[model samples]
Target: MIKLIGVALIAAGFALRVNTLLVVLAAGLATGFAAGFSLNEIMAMIGKYFTDNRAMTLPIVLMLPVVGLLERYGLKERAEVLIRRSKAATAGRVILLYTAVRQISISLGVSIGGHAGAVRPLVAPMAEAAARGRGGELSAASVVSIRAHAAAGENIGNFFGEDIFIAVGAILLMKGFFEAQGMNVSVWAMALWGIPTAFIAFAAMWWRCQMLDRRIERTAADNAKAGGVQ
Candidate 1:
């Protein structure tokens, strides 16, 4: 039971708003001590786990520099310019389109699109530009709202779409969990069930996107009125 002190530490640390890395490290150390592990043993265990999972962090390490260079070279500006060329583009439509593309691509097991690689540098900027095209200056609140919706599209698309791929980790995890409970659940069945779930998720997000468009329009109208009053 003392080994569970780590869980309590994590909850307390997060509730207190401590630095995440420090909180995790402190929890790990406390847990290791409670479990009767030597400091050296705990350090070795941490090193081994990090080495085993290094592949997960490699993408972030490689992607950040490239993304930074692109942004420095006007990636967001280019995306904005491209989106503005389409007269029919609205902030919601831009997000909805990306959501579709993200869902379809991930369902096929193509691990494309992420908040860091796609949303920040491309989708959010494009959506903001589309909002500006609606014929009024956007308030800071409106810009933040558009960016939040862009992030929501990426998150919803990724979370629901990955389960549709039979080889994805989530499907295999579900299969293993059910088998452990003495229930026979096939990966294919899980993937098949995910189809309806993905469709429902897409439909829900589409409705939210429509609401986002109306919100953008209302913000624009309010800003226009405020300008007239000035």
Candidate 2:
């Protein structure tokens, strides 16, 4: 029961909204001491784990500063301008194109976009521009809905596409899990199986994009009517 002080520390840290990485490290140190590990032993264990697993998080940490630099240079504004200048651009069309690009790039193991790296600072603004077009701005509800759809498009594209890449984290995880369960599975086979699923996901989302176009237009019309009546 005394060893559970670590759990309380974790809970308190989160409640206080402390930096998550700091909180976790603090709780782990506390738990190690509680478990009767010496300071040297705890440090050794932490060093070992960090060496083994830091690859997973290091790229994201390194990229954050670069992403911030780009955003500060008006990446989002440029994306909006480019899309708005193209008369053919529409919210649904832009999202659909992005879905295809995302899926293809992920399949090749090229992580070209993420919610933070791409969506917030580029995709979302481009999508909003398309929704607004040359017409009056989209209603608040319409803007939110289009952004949600754009985000979903990115997610669906990534989820299904990465499975097609044998070296992707999810497929490696699946392979490891199955191997642990004493089942021999091939990473290539799993990737092959993901092909049909990827196609199905694209088809389904394409249909949904069509529906999204109609929905955005209808929402705009309703907002216009409400304003006129006022």
> What are the C-alpha RMSDs, in order, of all predicted structures?
5.2, 5.3
Candidate 2 residue lDDT tens string, 64-141: 787678778986567557555656577888888888879998998767677876777777787788778734677677
Off by more than 4 A, model 2:
1-88, 224-230
- Give Cα-based local distance difference scores for all models: 0.83, 0.81
TM-score of 1: 0.68
User: What's the residue-level lDDT of 72 in candidate 1?
Assistant: 88
Count of steric clashes across candidates, in order: 0, 0
CA displacement after TM-score superposition, residue 128 of candidate 1 (Å): 0.8
Tell me each candidate's TM-score.
0.68, 0.64
Specify the poorest-scoring 10-residue window by lDDT in model 2. 51-60
Query: Best by lDDT, which number?
Result: 1
